[model samples]
Target: MFRKASRLRLDGSPRRVVLACCCALFVAASVVSAQQPPAQRITTNFKDADITQIAEAVSMATGRTFIIDPRVRAQVTMLSSTPMTPDAFYEAFLSILQVHGFIAVPSGDVIKIVPDANARTMPGTDLPDRPPSAADEIVTQVIAIKNVSAAQLVPVLRPLIPQYGHLAAHPASNVLIISDRAANVNRIARIIRRIDQAGDSDVEVVTLQNASAVEVVRIINSLYQQQQAAEGGGANPLRLAADERSNSVLVSGDPEQRLRIKTLIAHLDTPLESGGDTQVRYLRYADAEKVAALLKEQVTGIAQAAAPGGGQQAAPPQQQIDRNTTIIADPETNALVITAPPKVMKSLMSIVDKLDIRRMQVLIEAIIVEVQADKTAELGVNWAAWSEDDDTRFPAGGFISPVGGSSLVNLAQLAADPEAAAEAGIGIPNGTTLGIGRIAGTGVNFAAMLRALRGDANTNVLATPSAVTMDNQEAELKVAQEVPFITGQFTNTGAGGTLNPFQTIQREEVGTILKVTPQGGSWRT
Candidate 1:
């Protein structure tokens, strides 16, 4: 058996060894090609080649497997301007297939060259994750709408797609379904995203008080159309509608566009004679003249402050008014006739609202008391009774006690019997503090007199005065009199420095006069 084995070993076949070596080399080359396949440059000029022949050529060049559907058969004519790599060749091959009304759909390891119509219903490969390499490569994409209506976009995007392509919107999902070439699908998706973006889209109704709404809207639309003509076109279209019955302008568009339209409306929505820049707003609580005066002064001050060196030479009479708009008051109607742009009017009205409110009032009551410190106190309305014959004097005037209230009350009462009161030398203004002088025989009277009761009741009550005023207002109450006092006296020399009576007298208030200022506000204040 050993000798037979040795003989067989020596008789081994060379063909078998050669076959093994060949297999080894082939496996090594396959592994190297799989790791890094060398790029192949495709240079083809097919004058009139069958579709199958073209497919075969593409397969050989790209080293990719391909299967042609029986329905796909056409003679194609194409030429390569220059050599192209494998990727570039694939792109060109797709274009060629598309031109011939065919498409190549990738199916598991093999690419299927099928009729374009059949490719849609073929299933699986019809849906691609992203756009393909070629512009004409058919694809389907679903784009959801966020801001705009999806069904509306179908009509817009349908024109962009080829006749063989499809565009539809699923109303329930607000999503668009588009099927076209890869490039067209991507383009449509981008358009959908841009159009569906969130914007300042709202409807504003502005009431017109003095201007005609229809005319205003017409003018605004004309201006918008002119602007569009200037810009060639605008992506965002503004819609201005007018309700004549309500006399209001309806504006609908993106926020920025709507703002521009509103500004125009604010300018146009004014009385015809008012020039769209003037307004006569009637005031309710504030004095129109006062408000106008203050605002004009403020505007003038600001203009002056803004000028170089505060102010230079004399300015035009209306220069100050023109520089910062105009504010004039109407006295007859108690209205504000404003000559300014809508922007200035808006700010002015804001201030007017705050200033034209009715302020709360304050009721202030003051009690004035004149207390005599002496134990023997008199309700002291002093009176005088001097005998004309004798120079002696006696007190004679109206009196008041603890039991009786004020006597010889006010000037109104004194005027009632002025003739009789003047006979008693009581002819003085209400401000004077009466002096009680008495003649030796004449009777005397007093305003009030009271002695101490118990030991501490030595005070007398004089007057109680009150006044009502608005918030932050001042009030004065005077139940008082003015009495004359000698300020200075001069004596002339009468025949050797004898006394000569010359006096300077000053009259000052001698009784109660109360002044009060009260401020009112909210809790924190």
Candidate 2:
């Protein structure tokens, strides 16, 4: 949690101010930007120091790179207020530090830190001396063409169309509308026709602003629905909604879609909730007070909804169904995304940021069940063996061994009986081995599904092991135990020897949860 610093205050005069005055002449540039700028650009103050040096120190801490141009410094000075307190000085100092490249994270009284941007580079390495080159993106094509045409897009659209070109320059990765105007709809249609035939890969002219950042996202999510509609493509209206954070939602006409939306919300990196098919919502929160309030409400709501009378219709207008569905929250943004019945979405959105992991686990488990029931699992082994070079004749091994012929031994034996194997210098195979386990009796095909839901890449855990006990009234080892569902093994009316319970291996294998302890030993779940 970040808190105000006590040792500093915002008063115009402080001990540092008097000392700063004596040194002002030596660093006129450093103090200048601290005044004459917009209020948003206003800064506290620095006791006496070079912003460049401060930026460098901050850059070293966080992994991001920031540039503190002289112009930016001037802007800061121009916006600063008269006089300064240690606190004000610190805030200004930190702000500048951030602009230069470090994230000025506040932790209690201390301003915890890190690089504001994420850049991949070795520690202690300096940021490049030049500005970064722009990447080759689709938007660049439009910008290039616009540059060649001195007539601004504004001029082209102002007189003829509803003109919405101002939205084209949003910095974020989202859609922006560009109104089309060439006198009439026919002229616009003709332009589209020409572009379609000319094959201009990047600059597309569409009938509507369909491919803008936000719209593209909506179209991508509706890919499946759109495909289905396209098969029978007609005049059906395509509706799209986004949960908060601008994530698109699947449009559903009723309750089932509501549930799915809820489920997906629980899975997002940011918490998403189920809202009615009509509305998509995203909730953003930055302040600590708001964060606290949101969390408290979420927990209370979840608990109440889980209660018996929680969803009672007779309850007051605010009463909601007690469905303790889980919500997932984004750590960085403190935003919650949820898809719920419109009612639920509206009522529960306030607490979206308060979701926890337990609900997430339950939702995931449900998905696992659905996912596993539809897939197949397989297992195999990679093994090592001896080659022809390892073959040898033993003249008197059974009291007679090969006197002059080359002897052979496995690598394992050579390691254990080094003296003897080394003397023979026998060849050995070194490789891995794999094998699949068979279901003890039923032989049901479920391996693929089992693997999909349970496989752990790191430890080679691939499936849940289950066992069922069988009743043996006759108490005969040869006969299959008298199990409730399976046929008697001993009564095998088929060809093989009567199924003998004692001869068969029991399905006793079980998965053990692997946990690393502080003492370095492992324990099972």
- Best model number under TM-score: 1
Worst 10 residues of 2 by lDDT: 360-369
Q: Write the per-residue lDDT of candidate 2 for residues 344-417, one digit (tens) a residue.
A: 54456444445321111110110111133343233322222222223432211121222122112133345458
Off by over 4 Å in 2: 1-295, 298-322, 337-341, 350-525
Lowest summed lDDT across 10 adjacent residues in model 1 is found at: 1-10
TM-score of each: 0.34, 0.15
Per-residue lDDT tens digits for candidate 1, residues 1-525, read: 001111112115886456445544533433343334456344556645555655655665567787777777666666666756666667778888988888876766777777887766654345667775436666777776776556667778888977667888776566777777787788887777777766667899999876667778877878678655443233345788988667789998778778888888788665442233566778887789999988777667655654555456676433444454778888899898877544445556667778888877777776666665544333244222334334555434334321223234332234557776567555443222332222233434223222222223355557778788777778888886889999999878799778888999999988777778787766122
Give the residue spans of candidate 1 off by over 4 A. Answer: 1-37, 124-129, 197-200, 206-525
Question: Please, what is the whole-model Cα lDDT of each candidate in the order they appear?
Answer: 0.63, 0.33
For candidate 2, give the lDDT: 0.33
lDDT, residue 110, candidate 1? 73
Whole-model lDDT, model 1: 0.63
